[model samples]
Target: MKRLALTTASLALAAGMAFAAEHETTVRMGTEGAYPPYNFLNDSGEVDGFEIELGNELCARAELTCEWVTNEWDSIIPNLVSGNYDTIIAGMSITDERDEVIDFTQNYIPPASSAFVGTSEDADLTGGVVAAQTATIQAGYVAESGAALIEYATPEETVAAVRNGEADAVFADKDYLVPIVDASGGELMFVGEDVQLGGGVGMGLRESDTELKASFDAAITSMKEDGTLNEMILKWFGEDAATYE
Candidate 1:
């Protein structure tokens, strides 16, 4: 009887420890460390970008010890639901389809346009071979707009396809492609009208993580209220870019 009591106590203690662990203190922030200007690996090979800056600020405001984790964009949401990370800080636009699967904080970045770039000034805007990163809103738009869509695993690969003539053009977030076009020295240029899709970008969280979502949402609200988020938008996307305001 004494041995059984000791064993029961040990199991109860272990269960308590597990319960405590479920309420993790440190929040693991996830990002796609490949999207330049939004999130990317810097020369030092560390994740660096506007999202990284904003996420760190949010974490600070929330008084949470947050650590960054990189994941490919293709499987980012699935992985988040699987508990590979606690929160997704990538530049993911809030959409109804996505909302059904996961929860989002209020948008941090305001809605931005998506544009198509091609080598030819007169490239066909419709029914042309267009490249876009797989599973992105841009890809869905391309596919639905009577354009022949070719999906690539990464944004870089989609751009490469256009450059190599594998695709007639590439469609992506206008802000993400603007700097590339500018630096291309006339090699690349926008050829079609900018298409606006999806709501503004927000941090993704599992539906079960209501408390964590509230913390991030509060941080974002604080930034918006203080004009810091607008400042960040201008710093990263230029003065004309959209903001929470």
Candidate 2:
């Protein structure tokens, strides 16, 4: 899951109240179209990934017309607060700090671990320069864990830092790192213990949009009850990924 430290002003109540009137039939879903396995631009250059597929199903279940919107991770929340989108279905983790800015649906993905990947298996994680996406939970963890932290604007750049010898390791979601490591052949490998952080992944919405929130929440619960949610998780994250149980 992704967790960005938010510093923007809260959304106005007027905007939240206007949501139902302005888009009763349609919902705009904002995402960072870079993070793979969660949300990404496919070969056809359209948003396509696990979240894209699951979000469509969620919208259909809630009977709401939905459209996709792409934004930089750093500005994703601010844009939502300014009415650029109706909801955020990116790989954003549910955290108390974020809850102060926008409401979150009950977790759609269970809590997962953060991990470090480096070019070498013996990389010095405690003292080496570590790279992480700016304002992410992994970045914060790196800063406080005694490693010299380097921040990148995108997740790919963080991985690149390790490849280019600019960083000793790159820390991020273990699921996000898994495919990268596998594709690297022998170039990259996980270097440290998996660290658990954040609660889980969820949809971020304005506080006043309680009706829409309830609709989506009910849809999520229905999916959980019928086992579709678990099926989707395993489909994207493989058999070892966490589930609702």
Candidate 3:
């Protein structure tokens, strides 16, 4: 009788574990599907980029089902707070100001340099009209750097402002501007010294979602340990981009 009861208990436990695995938690990942190489809409209009792939991997590792959600960059945080999405996987940098409203996973990408792209090689970086996406670190830097700051809602618009001569240069992450400058055919070139801003990028979650944050943090740590995160970073950002030491 004792042996039979023990076998029945073990079977029941295995069945319960199977049921739990089949019904994993679903998490919505929000991104600004506009920042290329980081996150963007592909030719088929689906969200596709480094973050999308990385977010999916993290979700799988954490045994969570993920749904991608696209939000405008300016309102990304507000929407996350309002429950439009469970977490922000957008290439958001970790900063004390942002932490006041939401918690963040450990840094995924390392701190990167921001650079200025201008029509002319000699374009004035300071005391000149500079364009930056609103609410970005580059925008804040431009505003306080003695430059006449012009803010745009989208990163594309900031680049366009420089092309149209509305602004002398556009200030943004060097990783974002590298391909654009190379594709500009000499129309746009990097000017002035590179500026490092903000801490490394990480996923943003509401402070209440401590469990969710832990899952992602662990997934990120695993990727970093096995060199998979560095591989993905280089695949997207190229050889010159920073990686874990």
Candidate 4:
């Protein structure tokens, strides 16, 4: 009877271990895979970008397995609220308006000033016709400043508009627009000083998921301390673009 009881206890312990091993918290992350150098598809059609690398690091630090879901840029928040994803890791800026609907982790990436680029070498539309993605901070700037706002669905569209002379200049985050400018082979040039966009990139979590948000904030802090964050930034944007401060 003693041997039988011991065998039963061992089986129970083994079953508990199996259950624990099989149970892993999965986090569904959303991103618009069109933002190059942030979260875009590569030539091979795989998601290979800065935000993707950073997301992997955050998942590792939090001890969670992440499933990335690509969505349209405009629908990222609506889909998040509709239960399409648990968190948003796209290069999303944290703003007062967004805060009303979702909670954000501490700024993992600081916001760089926005810049305007034009096709003409002497394109002096510093305060003239401005093109930015609709509903974005850049658009807000154009609206407030009374610039002719040419709205586009994506950054690529805005860039294309400038290249095709459909718009005078393209206004967007420097990190996103710089690569496009370089790739345009001198077709685009910076028109003016960078415009301040008072926000930073952060992980967007549902308001009710405070526990998950806290975990993500802690993981991001730990990664920043250990230099893992810097390394990934460098890998994506080169050494000069790794500033987190």
Candidate 5:
């Protein structure tokens, strides 16, 4: 009888320890470490970007310790669902299709979409055109019109296709592609007015982590209120680009 009682006490103590560890509030964050100005490896080979800074700010606001892990963009969602990470701070857009699989925090940035086209005089993709990258929302826009589509694996590849006159245009997030455009030496232009994608970049987590989601949402809200978010935005994208509502 005494042995059984001791066993029971031991089990209870183990359970308590597990609970404490679970609620210890350490956030394991994931990022692509490829998307620049959002999350990427800097010249010093260190992980540094807008999302990285924002993650630190959010952690501070929530009083949580954060550890960042770099992962490929395509695998980020799957790995998060498999418990490889606690949250994804990658510059992931909050789309309804993605929401069906994982939960996302409230948007922390304004949505900005644009199209890039080659500078060649013969290349013209204007007024309702197709885009490279079929899985993207831009592909959906192209499919709506039954237009011929151009597809590629990465934004850089898509932009290269446009520059090479293989593709008419590449639709992508303005913030992600704007730097590439400037570096292309007038080889690309962001045509037409910006398209509001109706979703902003946010952190992603497993659907079962409701408490963590709530905590992250609250932290983001606090950062916004305290001007920490705006400050970080300015630091990365300059003052003009920092003017986000």
Candidate 6:
């Protein structure tokens, strides 16, 4: 899930392509198969993650035949517009900028916080080098926060930027950072208060695909209403994660 917030040009292109293929029955779900717990490639090189499992369930509920497609975060929206995929099932935030280009199903995941992390607890919070994945919300925030923002193509590189002293800290989703910090064996720790950004995460569809959007919206609502959504949250993001209910 790249914070690759939506783009206007890409969204328009995607809408046009989708209109031409509106009658297609097979749904291709696009995702960044690099963000863990959201969507990522398993050791077997298959797309697997919290969003993957949840997406499969949603497809089943919608009675749609779903196929997974991996894409880079930076060009995800443009790719979707080009008919590279029919829908985006990545952990994409529902923001007005994104809404301008593509339609969204009702939020599937609740709002979540982004965390700051570094090797030392006292790492610079301002005016210091900070790293974030390119096109992500974290990168945007860092750029505006007066920090020296070094952007990378992938989340893994952002973490690498901090470890190699290219940056003093990294800004990223708390859930993504938690496992890294835990596995760092005391080499890393979170610093600074968590920053909440964007609206809840949702599935992205072509603006013209109201029927597809409605189908997924109904499925998402069913999960939230039945508590299955919250269960998936606990399973993926831990009990402390905020739930819909």
| Cα-based TM-score, every candidate | 0.90, 0.90, 0.90, 0.86, 0.80, 0.89
Runs of candidate 6 exceeding 4 Å displacement: 1-24
**Per-residue lDDT for 1-245 in model 3, tens only?**
64664454345434433433765656889999999999999999999999999998887666677899999999999999999999998888888999999999889999999999999988988878999999988998999999999999999999999999999999999999999999999999999899989998999999997667766776776687668999999999999989996
lDDT of each: 0.86, 0.86, 0.88, 0.78, 0.72, 0.85
Model 2, residue pairs in steric clash: none
Worst 10 contiguous positions by lDDT, candidate 2: 1-10
Consecutive 10-residue window with the lowest summed lDDT within model 6: 1-10
Error of model 5, residue 129, in angstroms: 8.2
TM value for model 2: 0.90
- Model 5 residue 203 CA deviation in Å: 1.1
Better of 3 and 4 by lDDT: 3
Q: Assess candidate 2 and give its lDDT.
A: 0.86
Ranking by lDDT: 3, 2, 1, 6, 4, 5
> What lDDT tens digits, residue by residue, belong to model 5 across residues 135-157?
56666666564556776655567
The whole-model C-alpha lDDT of candidate 4 against the native structure comes to 0.78
lDDT of 1 by residue, 1-245 (tens): 64664454445434433433676567889999999889999999999999999999987766677889999999999999999998888889999999999999989988889999989898776978999999999988888889899999889998899899999999999989999999999989999688889998999999997767776776777677668989988999887788764
TM-score of 6: 0.89
Q: What is the RMSD of candidate 3? A: 7.7
